[model samples]
Target chain A: MEELGPLFVHPYQPDQFWILILIVSLPAIVASLYVLIRGQLPAALSSSLMILLPLVAYLLGDIHLMDESKRVNYCGSCHEAMSPMFETMHNDDSTLAGFHYKRGAISHQTACYSCHSGYGLSGDMTAKLAGMRHMLQTALGSEDYPLRLRRSFDIDSCLDCHAEAKPFRAIEDHRELDIQEALLARDMGCTGECHETAHPEEARHGAAAFAEAR
Target chain B: MARFAALLILVSQLLLLRIVFDTTGPPSTWFTFVGHPLVAAGAVLGIWALTRRLIREAHEHKMAEREDH
Candidate 1:
C-alpha cells in the first residue's frame, strides 16, 4: 500500500511543536525555580515564568493533541481491537472504508476520523471526547472489542459531502422521498444493504479472532 | 505554596510530555484525568503566592519610609 507522509511535517505541527515547547519549558522551569527560591527575580516575573508559560503551553498542547487524535494511526494505537479495522481499511477492497481509502475519496491519514466524526464543532468535540473515553477504557483494561460506536452512525455526516453531489442525486432510490427521510432520520443506514459496512466482518468480530490467529 | 506549585507544574509537564510522545497510551489517560487539573491548580497557587509577595513588599517599603521619617 502507498503510504501517507507523517502528520507533523512542519515545525508548527503538533509533534514538532510539542517537542519545541518541551525544550523551552524544561530548562526554563529549572531556572524559574532557582530564581523563585532565591528571591532574585520579582514575584510577578517568576510567576509568569512558572505559571503563565506552562498554562499557555498546556492549552496549546491540548489543541495539538485534539488534532492528533483525528489521525488514523492514533485510533489504531493502544488497542489490538482496532487493528483489523485498520487492516480492512488498508487492504480489504469490498468494504466502504477500503474503497474510499484505495480510491482517494477520503484522506488515508485521517480516514477513520473523517467518516466517524460528526459535523460541526459540537460533533468534533463529541468525537474527541469519545476518543478520550476509548483511551481511558484501554488504560483501564475495560474495553469490550469488536468496538462498537456509542450511537448509530449519523447520516448527516455522509450527506455533508454526498447529499448534493451529482452522482449521489442521480440514484433513483436516493431520489425517493421516504427513503431520503428514512436516511435523514437514520431509520435507514447509508452503509446498510445497498452500500454494505464501512469495514470488513472481521473488523467487527473484535480482537478475539486476531488473538486466536496469533 | 511555592514548593507545591513547582511540584504540580513539574508533574503536569511530565504528563503532557507523555501524552505528546505516547499519545494513545495509558499515560495519556492519566493526563486527561489528572494532569490538566494539576496545571490549573498550579497556576492559581502561583498567582496567589505572587499576590501575597507583592503585598508584603509594599507593606515593608511603607514601614521603612515611616521609620526614616
Candidate 2:
C-alpha cells in the first residue's frame, strides 16, 4: 500500500487518526450509555451530551471520511478492477496519470482525485456520490471488469487546475481562439485531439489487456 | 423524544465508529452508504428534538410573561 503521507493528519497513523476522532466523541458515547442505563437525565445536560457532542463528532467523522475517500489508495481498494490503473500510474510514464505521478505535479496521496474530481464543494460531493455508486456496484457483483467510467470525463477537472497556469497558456496552439473556445466549452477534450489520454485505451483493445494489466 | 434522539445518536455513532475502524482502504459499502445516511439522520433528529424543546420552552416563557403583565 502507498503511504497515506502528509495528506492525512500527521503524528498519527491512519487508524490512529480515526481513533483520535472516536476519542473526541467518547464523552457523548459514555453519556449516551449512561442515559440508556439510567432511563433519563436533566434536560439541559441530556441535550448537551446526546445532541451537541454527538453532532460535533458526526461532522468531524464525516468530513474526515470524505477526505480519506479521495485518496489514491482508497480508490485502488477494489483491487481487481483498479489494479491496472494503479499499475499504469506507477509503471507507465506514457499516460497522463503516470506523467503527473512521475513529475510530482499531484499529491501521491490524492493523485486520482485531483484530476477526476472537479473544483469546489459541489465537485467533491459529486465525486463522493459516484464513489458510493461504485461501492454499491462492486458489492452487487455488477461492476464490469476493468470498469469504465459511467459518464464522459469532465474537461473542467483539467481546466480547473491548468487553465491559468503559465506553461499551459504559453503554448501557441493553446492560444488559438477557436481551440480555446472549444476546450472551455468541452467540445474538444483535453486529451482528444492533441494530448495523450490519462490512461491507455482500454476501451479500444477490449478486456484482455485490462485483465492482463491487473 | 429525547431518549429516542439519544438512541439514534448512539446507534449512528457506533455505525460511524465501525466505518472508521474497518475502512483500511476502500470504504465498506454497508458503512459508507448506510452508515453515513444514518448518521446524518441522527444529527437531523437530534437537532429537531433540541429545537422542539427550545420552542416549547419559549412558548411557556411567553405565557408566563403575559400572566405577569
Candidate 3:
C-alpha cells in the first residue's frame, strides 16, 4: 500500500496567490473529474489525483467565512439579538453608522469594526474577543436582546480618526472644551447630547429595518 | 472527486486562513464551530479512503505472489 499524505494543515497562502493556484490546479482538477466521474481513471492510484478537489472547496468556504465576519451584512445577521442594531445601520445610512460608514468617514470594509474597535494594536483583538463573547452569549441565549454597549464606547476610537481633523477640532463648541477630559470623565455629553443614541429607540426594533437588512 | 475536493478545500482554507485571522484578536469561536468539523470530516474520509485502497493493494499483492509460487 502506498502512503497517503495527511490532509489537515494550517492555511498560510496569500489571497492573490489562490487565483494563481486555482488557475493551474483548476484545469487538472476538472480534467481529473472527467476521469474520476466516468470511472476510467488513468491510474488505479487516481484517488491521489483527486485529493486537491475537496481542499479547494473547503478553502473557498473558509475564505467566505472569514469575509463574512468583517462584512457589515454578515455581522448584522450573526445573531438575532443584534440583528436590529445592524438593520438600523443598513436601513438608513443617515443613521449614525450610516452617516459615517455610508459617507466613507470610515472605510465601508471596516465600517462596524472600525468604530467598535480602537486605534491601537489591541483594538482589532479586543473587537474579536468581544465578538467571541457575543457568539457564546448567543449560543447560550444569555445576552439581552437589543444589547447596549458591553463597555463604554471609547471616545478614543472616535477621536483616533476625528480628533486631529480640522473639522472636528474646529467645531465652535469643541474649541471651548477639553474633549478628552470631558468624555473620559463621563461628565456631560457623548457624541453630543442631541445625537446621543446611535440607533433610536424606535429604529432599534423597526420591522422594516429588520426586514430590509435580511 | 468529492473527497478530493474536500481535501483541496481544507488545505486551501488552512493555508489562506490568515487573511481572515490577520487581525489581533482570538479567532471567533464561530471559526472553530464551522471550520473544525469540515476539517475533521475531510481528514477522516481521506484517511479511510487511503486505508481502504492500501488494504486492497496488499491483498492483490499477496494473491499475485501466491499465483506465482
Query: What DockQ does each prediction reach against the true complex?
Result: 0.53, 0.33, 0.13
Cα miss at A208, model 3 (Å)? 8.7
Q: Per-residue lDDT of A66-117 in model 1, one digit per residue for the tens?
A: 7777888888876566877877788877888888888878876788898888
How do these models rank on DockQ, best leading? 1, 2, 3
| Candidate 3's DockQ | 0.13
Q: What local lDDT does model 2 show for residue A183?
A: 70
lDDT of 3 at B19: 31
**lDDT-superior candidate, 2 or 3:** 2
- Chain A TM per candidate, in order of listing: 0.82, 0.74, 0.60
**What is the CA-based DockQ of model 1?**
0.53
Model 1: what TM-score for its first chain? 0.82
Chain B TM-score against the true chain B, each candidate: 0.90, 0.72, 0.61
A5-76 in candidate 3: lDDT tens per residue?
A: 444332333356445435534544464456435633344444444444444544564554444566565465
lDDT of 1: 0.76
Model 3 lDDT tens row, B24-58? 22233434455556555654565456567668789
Q: Between the candidate structures 2 and 3, which one is better when assessed by TM-score? A: 2
Q: Which lDDT tens digits does candidate 2 get at residues A43-132? A: 678667776777677677777777777778787776655667777788888888999987878878889889887677888888888877
Error of 2 at A113 (Å): 1.3
TM-scores for all candidates: the values are 0.83, 0.70, 0.54
